[model samples]
Target chain A: MKGKPFFSSVVQKLVIGITGLLLCGFVAAHLAGNLLLYSTSDRYAAFNKYATTLHDMTLLPAIEIGLLVLFVVHIGLTLRMQFQSQKARPEGYAVQKSKQGRGALAARNVMHLSGIVVLAFVLLHLADLRFGLRFNEAGLAPAQTVLQVLRDPISAMFYTVGSLLLGYHLFHGFQSSFQSLGFGGERLTRIVKIVGILFSVAIAVGFASLPIWVTLLRK
Target chain B: MSESINVTLKVWRQNGPGEAGRFETYPLENVSTHASFLEMLDILNEKLINTGKMPVAFDSDCREGICGSCGLMIDGQAHGPDRETATCQLHMRRFSDGDTITIEPWRARSFPILKDLVVDRSAFDRIIEAGGYNSINAGNAPDANAILIPKIDAEAAMDAAACIGCGACVAACKNASALLFVSAKVMHFARLPQGKPERETRVARMVAKMDEEGFGSCTNTTECEAACPKGISFSNIVSLRRESMRAQCSGRSTR
Candidate 1:
């Protein structure tokens, strides 16, 4: 991939698409694991067990590192592509109207902006829950840590907003990655689009349920 | 009787490539709703010339949509408001009396404005010259059914062939990407048997040339398809990405 710029240049767009789809897989898996928080019993038996067992794996650190690399590559490559696109048009039109009509959601035009929102949310989420920057959850089970963070009003609200925007990001990003790879037929493409919408909504709603259950409902 | 409407034209005026551009307003009265957008421009130019002022220079040929020669960013919509209509085909009835219409050239790093509403779209020509052709020997249009093409393949190729080399897709794209235009040409060939010989190299070379022309990469906003006068589907772009990937994985060079 080095020495020959053509190799790098040609695959630049492909890298973003491939990395994005991989990250979508990560998001789905993470959502599944987080749903373990809903398994409440006395002292949260199921949730605590799930957390303890997950951390006990020798492959935990390897998985974490691999996830971090995916984040860096997906985010970094897309930003570079956006900047190049900006340079492609030196001047903008005076009053452009969208022809896609209502199909052009505000999210469609601002993938980068939505991406930034998701990134900030991820950083704050890690701080509030995983790293215990906002709450001292060290030596505690992951489920307990999640509850403590979500029970905080400010943190819970942030999570709700963040999850929604992440959904918005995936709303386009989900099928867009498929389009980027050039995979489609009339029926297959339409199916992918519909499924992408469902997947995006499920991920958003699933994550937001944690905050809603912890801070608002269960309280 | 043809209903006439008065319009205020905010036309972008530039002396040359390096010259500063500004909107010069002209109030055109009694423009027939039956007149095409180019005809309105013609009326405006005539009025300007009669007043001893420099007339705005814009591109127009055949005075109809098929040539793909006339285009403008009228009110910021490529070829004006109507869907699947080029500039020459957009009628004045689309606008109301006393409406202010803004007209400008297609803006892109690869498309330099030559005058008021005319742009140097030779970039399209360059892309075509790259590898948009087949090296297979051809004497004449073969007997109608001699080649035995499948109906679906022929239809898809014809759909792609609708692209008229207009730059509206670029003007309307946020990133000024030429993927829609390039994809149309690529798909036009990819869907047919005659296009099989140089399939891999054709896409590889055209895409390389597209990048060299300083066009941006597609972000899948689908704006190009919406603005396309011929209604070229974004599926062509998807097909193009597949074609490009195949070519690259095969270790084919643009050369």
Candidate 2:
């Protein structure tokens, strides 16, 4: 990325691509960790304990730093891309309409929906995970802390719904990112589609299940 | 079914940009509903030519809808009442024999009216020239199957290239946004392996030219697709945004 203008629209997209891949990797790891909640033995308990060990002392700071960096880059890149796109057409087309074809929804609303997910989910996620678990001054035990939020049917439902929305974002976005990366070709297209579906489903199910397992199964 | 109907046509008649323009009305009887709109226009023009008057000037080449040249605003709608047919392909069955049809040229600051209904759309050509292609003018044609592109990507590129460079998109857009048009071109080239070398440059320059051409921002109203003869998808536009972002990130030089 040397000769290109530093703040060009393509650079913004590259930042988005890099940060998006990081986020996707994080989602994969988080999904794997979330599956631990289903374990019936003390292993499940131990897993939580170990997970919280660093999360309680070290991981939180590192994660907050990493997340902050990723979010800033991701969002900054998005804003720049959008600005350039707006600047691309000054006076605008005299005859403008949605392109007539198969992809009306994903084409028109992906950006708008992605924007909504970031704003609403970030606040909700911090409250649910960051503030509730790590930063709570009340010092509720991790299990009790988790249960406190999940025990409420409404809160649990909200978490589930939010996770589903996250899945929708990832569903379209995962495939879209691969397309942007120039990854798809005749040999890998089917694989990309399959991986995209699996990734979205795994993330949605893992996240959605946490609330359900805590609220419904415990009751 | 042999009923003779009378209708008045308010057609835009402008000899040149310097000349005063007005709508001229013509009365016609026994217009078959089965004829295409351009065919109907042909009937009207033929009548005028027989009367020793100059036939109304409009653009219609490759009437099958691929060339993207035939566009008109019929009764406030681009390409008449059809959902996605070109004016040349639009049938008169969309209107009653007695219906008054108002035909107007595509109106945009970028697309100047050359004469009558024929507007000079070379602005699109200039935009394409500005950076709508890959620098890989690799002189020798490479083996067709050498690139190893996924069929899906190839299909996507083909979809973007389906754009016929018709100005219907400009006519249908309220803001006169050229995002769809520019995006289609950008995405078409950006999606292919052959296009990767100059991907960043192509997007940057094309977008820059699009802005210079005075096209408006896209408000997401899908009038362009409805009026499009080829029914190019809006997905190509999204692909454009994604590619633009990716290219900007990669720091590739624009050639």
Q: Compose the digit string of candidate 2's lDDT tens values, residues A56-153.
A: 68557788799889877877766655565445433332222243444435523465565566457667667776766433648665555666677767
Predictions in order: lDDT: 0.86, 0.70
lDDT of 2 by residue, B1-255 (tens): 443455688888889864667778898777787777788889999999999998999998898988988878777667776676778888766676577767778877787777778888898999999888656675677787866889988988898888889887877775566777888888887778778778888888887676667665553445566666677775665567667767656877354
TM-score per prediction, in order, is: 0.96, 0.63
Candidate 2 overall Cα lDDT vs. reference? Answer: 0.70
Q: What TM-score does prediction 1 earn?
A: 0.96
> Candidate 2 chain B — worst ten consecutive residues by lDDT sum?
B214-223
Alpha-carbon runs more than 4 Å astray in model 2: A1-11, A56-60, A80-110, A133-139, B1-33, B39-67, B71-86, B92-122, B131-163, B167-204, B211-255
Error of 1 at A123 (Å): 0.9
lDDT of 1 by residue, B124-212 (tens): 99999988988887568989899988998889899999999889999999889999999999999988888977888899888878888
Which candidate number would show the highest lDDT if scored against the true structure?
Answer: 1
Candidate DockQ scores, in order:
0.66, 0.07
